[model samples]
Target: MGPSVAKLASHDRVWQSIRQSAAAMVAEEPILASLVHASVLNQLHFEDALNYILAQCLGTAEAPAILLHQSFDELTTAHPDVGAAARADLAAVCERDPACRSPLEALLFFKGYHAIQTYRLAHALLNKGRRPLALHLQNRMALTFGVDINPAARLGRGIMIDHGTGVVIGETAVVEDGVSILQGVTLGGTGKDEGDRHPKIRRGVMIGAGACILGNIEIGARAKIGAGSVVLQNIPPGCTAAGVPARIIGRCANTEPARDMDQGFDDVEA
Candidate 1:
């Protein structure tokens, strides 16, 4: 199978849960019933519903909603992995964010989830040599969500970007699976660079809000970065870095900082 076959088996359970949640929301807030139906219930499949929702959100006069919707549907049809990644991301949000009430809330209302999903779509298109369209989607996403992630950047599944506003990931940045990044974070470059300039974020890393990790550095796996710090050097695995020009304050209290979502720096030395 090329990329069109439905990956229903993998997403079935979550899709059903999301549908139930959406229906519950409609019942609770009767005013939003029509929107909830159009966003989830009316669609034939999960991917179809997602495509329609994002297209309506990012579509503009230059990029009509119908056209954008069809293109996103085609992308998902050609890439079942895209749908799979989106499912993982949705779950990541629901699991990690306390404020996230339901999977339907993550699917319909969260800009962080929306940005990541759209970035996945753009990344898939970029790999197919559709640079122009990929760039266009990235531009629209940045403008709409205040999160700017280049299409060329490589990101893995189960990414949770909490309060995604002002999240800027550079072109060559690489974020591995199960990474939780907060608002105002910047995975960027420090100086004039050519190729592979951005930071390489390892798996299970939790970067706090407004932390800037600049240059071609590697943030080791399961490391936690404190809020508002500037990460200039390579951080070791299972460590916690904080302060301006972040220092290794101490080891992560637990191995899975990303999954734990713990901001308690009580054990770490300032």
Candidate 2:
């Protein structure tokens, strides 16, 4: 009875799912799974949950998971020095959250983790010339997480998304280096045009929550987008945009505030 009790107590469905999924993942892409596993292990000591997420993306309800090792490896190889920045940013987030005890926990529990992972995987597919597959997965990630970023969307170093809900960065949305964005922001399209209908957010811009910058607008470098604003045109550098039909309201003093643009701070009110 004591042994049986211990066995039952040790059982965990979520962990079991992770293990099964990971083993199955070995078949699809052993090298890529190894690469992902290495990354996860380097950042997380016990990363079953993270593995579960990767598996979920690669798995089906009834079938074994497809690991896509080559795809994973290809994506990581595309950004050779990116892991350092990603780790640093993730560390910063963990420090800000009192509940986060380690980078491992942050990697496992944070929505940013999920969003970035989806983006990374999708980006890998995009790089592989799998446009339809990449776009399809990107859309699926958006529907699942409420944060939509295209794999083809060029994101530079130190990009952060805070409280990442309802954030839509359209196809061809070019976000340069050191940009931060809050939640509920849409760098979206204007109409049914086939190409180049989205905004181009330049480097070091801080976009606030619930702000909608529409059409083929170009938001200049270091510009600030205030919460809940709707912009239909271009915004110059060192400016702030606010209100419905968002307009230039103020000057941007600092690009880095309490929360980085990517930290989802824009969702504070909404």
Candidate 3:
């Protein structure tokens, strides 16, 4: 059919599958029945359930859960693309992460998913000139999920931040679509120099855990960054880099390393 119709069909399928998974969870582990129902089964729309979950997770004594729930609902209703990007992100996790068996798991359990969706909302707010509120969201996400992504950062759709703890993305960093970033990864600047001082990650790149990619470098498309590497300069497309001061170690076996989710640091040639 048409694009809108196809999108609706896809959205329907994703929501239905997540609902079935949540139901199965309730039946199998009766202990989590309340949580499953509240998080997934109770809501009519997928976005509503997501908003409720985010509100509950981000709420505190000062800002009540009910108010935050209303606020998030308004935000997503005003800007539906945030929810759409969230669905794409959920699909990315399901397709790339072996541990993510169902969309229900990514929706209700994964903090990486939670952090990304929250950043999307905060980014939208930042664009709308709600700086204080956006910063509040950024602070909450950092404290609660241990994932600190600046709201000003430009992140494209279909991103999967696996095991999201200790991940820090700088304010000027730009992460393109279909990128997979592991835990403890830092996309920070090298020095105190202001204005556009962060890495620009291209599409389908996979950055391993604890990889510190510092400075205003261009990480080319489908690049594979080895774990714990200290990258200082630009990397060409389809290449792998790894070391204390990471150099071009080799070329990747897989064309789409992010989608492939391969963590192998092989030796071939750039």
Which sequence of candidate numbers ranks them by lDDT, best first? Answer: 3, 1, 2
Q: Could you tell me the TM-score of candidate 3?
A: 0.94
Candidates by TM-score, descending order: 1, 3, 2
lDDT of 2 by residue, 1-270 (tens): 145533542474433333344445556668756644543422221233344445555444543344443444445557544444455456555544455555544554466556756676677678778888677667767766778888887676556666779888887888876676777988888788878888888877887778898888899987777778898988888677777887776665555432333323343221
Tens-place lDDT per residue, model 3, 15-109, is 87777788899999999999998888777678988999988998888877898788788889999998999999999999999998888999999
Structural RMSD, model 3: 4.0
Residue-pair clashes per candidate = 2, 13, 0
Stretches of candidate 2 off by over 4 Å are: 1-53, 62-70, 77-85, 88-102, 255-270
Stretches of model 1 off by over 4 angstroms after superposition: 1-11
Off by over 4 Å in 3: 1-11, 267-270
TM-score of each model, paired residue for residue = 0.94, 0.68, 0.94
Q: Which candidate, 2 or 3, would have the higher TM-score against the true structure?
A: 3
Q: What is the C-alpha RMSD of each candidate to the true structure, in Å?
A: 3.9, 10.1, 4.0
Q: After aligning candidate 2 to the native by TM-score, how far in Å is the CA of 197 from where it should be?
A: 1.7
